[model samples]
Target: MKGRNSIQFRIITGLLLILLLSVGVSIYLTTANQKSNLLDASQRTLAVNNEMLNTTIRNIMLSGEAPIANRTMEDFRKITGFLEFELYRTDGSTAFNDYDTLNFVNDYQSMVMFDQTPRVEGRSIDTEDFQQVLMNKTPVISLNEDTREMEYYFPILNFAECRVCHGDDEFIRGVSHFRISLDSIYDQVRRAGVLMAVYFVSVGVILFTWILLLMHRTIIKPVLDIGETVNIAATGNLDIQVDLDRNDEVGELAGRVNHMISGLRERRDLELQNKVIETRLEENRKYLDHIKEGLLLLNSERRITGQYSVFLTKLFMREDIAGLSLADFIYPDAERFADERRDLDGFLEMLFTNKTADMDMIMSINPLNEAVLQLDQDNEIIIRADFLRIVENGEMENVMVIFENLTDIVHSRHELEEERQRRESELEQIATVLKMGPKVFEGFIEEGERAFGSLRGNLTNFSDKEFISEAFRSVHSVKGTARYLDFPGVEEHCHQLENLFAEVRDGSRKVDKSLEETVAGTLDSLDDELVLIRKLIDRFKEFSVGSESTQVSPFNVFGERINDMVKDISNELDKDVVFNLETDLESVPGLPEIQPSIFHLIRNALDHGLEDIYERLAAGKPSESQLSLRFIHEDNWLKIEVEDDGRGLDMPALEKKGVEMGLLKPGVHLPSQIVNVLFRPGFSSRDEATSISGRGVGLDAVKEDIKKMGGRINIRTSRGKGTTFVLLVPWKGDEEGVLV
Candidate 1:
């Protein structure tokens, strides 16, 4: 109903109003004309009747037949449809009245003799018609609405015959007045008005019905169909169309609606195509993200703009890098790249500015190529960045930056190089040992021992600058001798020691307690290597045909070997280490089998337990750090202790490394538990591999070796002070007799 009240109702209502107004106008005009014609016809008929009556009266008076004229007028009045007919004298007296039977039309004495009724008496005689008839002596006509009649007054003019009776005294004789009822004409007009009203109403009804049907067919029905089709299309049904077949505005509207739906359907198909393309693009993005290499797209402004692989986020450690300047993302702090020549900013600027430049040349000089980014204090990664220029429409549009993480590759290369160097050193040492016969090898070993022993004696009298100078000279001499002997391993160790002392003597490095301890550790390592070389030579000596009678004392050899190994460690670490040989080696038995264990313990102490010279001093210890090896004969156990005045075990650092290696859970542990971490296979406190302790095999091997020797090692440590390792070997034989 509400929908119907809109255009359809308004159009029908407007048409009805217009039709009604037209009908009302037509009825008003027709009725007005009909009334005018009817009134005019009545007036003309009254005038003609008055004229005929006047002429008849004149003829009758001329023929001398007044009684006959009077009778005729009486009969005419009776026969005519007039309400009243009368004659009045000029003095306002009636000449003849219809109500009086004795009155005569032209009787001169009858007006006074008879009982006369005035024609105009008790009537409105002051009217214009009566005034004109009486004063001007002319006929006057007027209507009387109360009686529904037309009144006419005619002046009776004096003529020749009228003067013979009246003596010719006046020009006007009397007035004749007639009142004619217009009721029949009024009835006809009323009936005609009613019929016209009915006719107009009928025409309005028929026109209204015809208009309603035509509008429904031409407008309302088409609009409804279009509305329904629009509703369907709104529901995502673009196939709906209004099939209006007409050459009208509605047809044009239907055509437009069909075109709109066709456009909608095409748009929907395009949307589906876009959806599929977006899905494929997303999948491709995922694939790119998972690839090993990182990718970045930079616009012409050298800003990261378009899509980038997710790996780039991981590589750069940032997520919201799009729309950011490429140089800014790579190097956020400009001050860090202050060196203009080697600055990454210059490289990027050059590459971005010079479109036609060779990318290979730019890449060759690219500082970011194989750049090392320190992720944190303990973590770093090497990355190789490559830039490729993307050209579009003969212009450089973008640059694709590729980042490849080279940390593992670089580390692997280092490890391989180290391994190769180790193998070459070993083979060279073996070759040199073979080339130099037993006598020459023995001479070299004895000379090395004497030189190291002298250096150790001099280090005991530790001074600052003079002592460092002497140390450098002594290590340099030993290094030169080892080089001459082609003992590359010993030579390299001596060279490192030489470098340490040289740095100290030249003031490049401080000769603090830590430095002294470090030197001591390095010296100990070098001596250990020498001893191993000596042992190797001795093995070679055993193969000699004439070497069977060489009876060397085990006690002296063991003591000397221990001293050499400790001194080597002290020098190797660049420390001023004072080694005390407290054990009387002559009292020990089975020295040969226990030598390896002793060596392992001393090496472990040097590498893991001992502190550098600076650390010893910082701990309020001597600048010449102390390391002691002692042997004691208990009731049934042979005990050896190795202790150092150096930094104790870092239990926290050990625990952290353990957690990282997945060897131990994260928590506080007992000192013994922390110490046991040292012996866990493949667990080390060091974050990186080097020539020393990170292998994780040393302490574990030592523990196994000690266990095989029927000994267990115990560790004691004090924070900021030092550490001690005590080995207890069970002995069953008599101590005195077991000595060799």
Candidate 2:
């Protein structure tokens, strides 16, 4: 739409259209004229050639050389344009039929010498053009559409010279028929027409280009300039004037527009001067009176000034707030905030009396920053107080205090924190159960229940060495299993039970009611954890039963788990990562079974392979790093690759850590061998452990998992480029060419 409507487009389009039409018509007319003239000239040449044939035949016939005449006509037929040439008799019979014309001429010569009758008969002609020529006694030139040739029949009349050898019985002696093909001549005409057309089109194109340039320079550019100037003025910037200096209508329009802008500028200046003061006063009044927060100014005496926000009175639930002492206004109870009032006094003194006091330090120690005031028995609010210093002549005279009500925000934050913890606990429980597997979790749950039952049964026998030893064994075993299964809550409970039993063994605590209750409480907590596990197991069984009929794919579950893990790791590490999972897990045999190992590799990439936001940008990479996991079927192996565009392996750090861990000798080593040290247990370069990655068990476990599957893993790394870990496992395709 814009293309069709733009001035340049319209001008070029309309002008080119007109030029094309004119040029097309002129070229067409000129080409037609050229073709007509070429056809006429070609026809005249053919006629002259026909005359030459006639003159040749006549000269030979007048010399009484019949053989030469026949030979001459044969030569004429050999010419390129002549398709057919022959002589015919007056009765529409063929004349000069091969050597028969020579025979007839010899007979006439014999009759002239020995008085024999002259032969005038020849083969009879069959064509209608021959008969028409015979009857009309005129030359007939006509086009033959089927043969695409021109037929010419020129009548050869009997003359007195020919009556010397024989008597004249007919007026016409014969007709010379010439069938000439016009293909070559018409082709020449077409070529001339094409050349003329090309000439006219080239001239038209040149004229069109010149006209377009002239229009753009003289008209389009000037109009565009005027439009730009008008648009600027329309935006309320009346100070600008159009600067088109010409003696045309466009120039006149620019002058008028500039005059209008000048008048508008003057009017705007007058209006602004008249209303500036009033507008300022109205804005200030609106701000102070209607602001949501409380505003107040305090003099050195710590008294609220007369100039205060209307909200201040409403915040205190009292009128007559002006000129009130700050202490009374803020802490009306007088006894509840006694210490706060003293701190406020010192804070005010620092702001208004002290000359060299750091304002930042003063604000940091603001006593009323989070002051909770009870307006009524049922109504309480939290307000945060912020202070601004008011200086006059470089001397502090007053301080402005802004009281923002943060009651709703603080309460909402607490609620959000509680919700966040609840959801996090739920998620952690789900992850622990899923990772433990249904059968392993069931075993752990049964073991935990029996351990807790034994501890409960022996709570009264805390002093007995035999019972104490049994209880210690039970608690230790349960704790070990819980820790292995990643149930921190149950593990911690068993640890507490272990501590209580240890105290009993050392005889430092008496086996009284307090001891029994504490031990019983730990047992109860462990029992509750087992109960939650049992419920999760039941839900798992139900889901398994439902999923069989539903036919759920395990690969989708793997993908979702991987997505969640990547998101969690990204948030924990505070890194920007784009995780691209470019694989159809269901299409790769045995891939789903090794998803846990794949998850370890993914987490390692996000945690150790990819760089943080600032580190990436500093290295001239994008702030968001790229991490891709691909599973490809190559040959008879499933090739899995996990890659990252990040700060690559720190070889020196890895070598140093390997030396400290005794995984490598303190000597120069290839980076490949140094990187291989990462697959060893307890080999970590991190000084501290994070929730995402630090224990170094991920890569070690991954290597073990691949080893169990009869697969191998390889690592490729560059200094500052990135790292890719490739895993290849043997796989024979499934029956339907898909993994089950």
- Candidate with best TM-score: 2
Please give the CA lDDT of all the candidate structures. Answer: 0.71, 0.74
- In candidate 1, position 340 carries an lDDT of 31
Best of the candidates, lDDT: 2
Runs in model 2 with CA error above 4 Å?
A: 1-533, 537-548, 584-593, 634-636, 730-740
Clashing pairs counted in every model: 38, 4
**207-230 per-residue lDDT for model 1 (tens digits):** 899989999988888899899999
Q: Tens digits of per-residue lDDT for model 2 on 1-740? A: 35888888888888788877887788678767775676667667777878888887898778766656766777777988877787776666566544664567678667656332234335566688888888898887887545657888888878788776556887888888878887875676668767877887888889889998998887788877777878898898887887788888777887888888888898888888769866776787688888877888888778987667889778778877767788788877778878877887787777776668777877888887777888889888898989888888977788889889889998999899867864676676666445434655676677677768877776777778767765654555555445434566886786676666656665767899999999888778778778877887787777665343453244554455566667766987899888888975455577543554666677678878888998888888889888888988888888989999877888898998899878999889997789889887545677654544564556766776688789999888898999999998887577222111
Q: In angstroms, how far off is 519's CA in candidate 1?
A: 83
What's the C-alpha lDDT at position 10 in model 1?
Answer: 91
lDDT of 1 at 663: 76
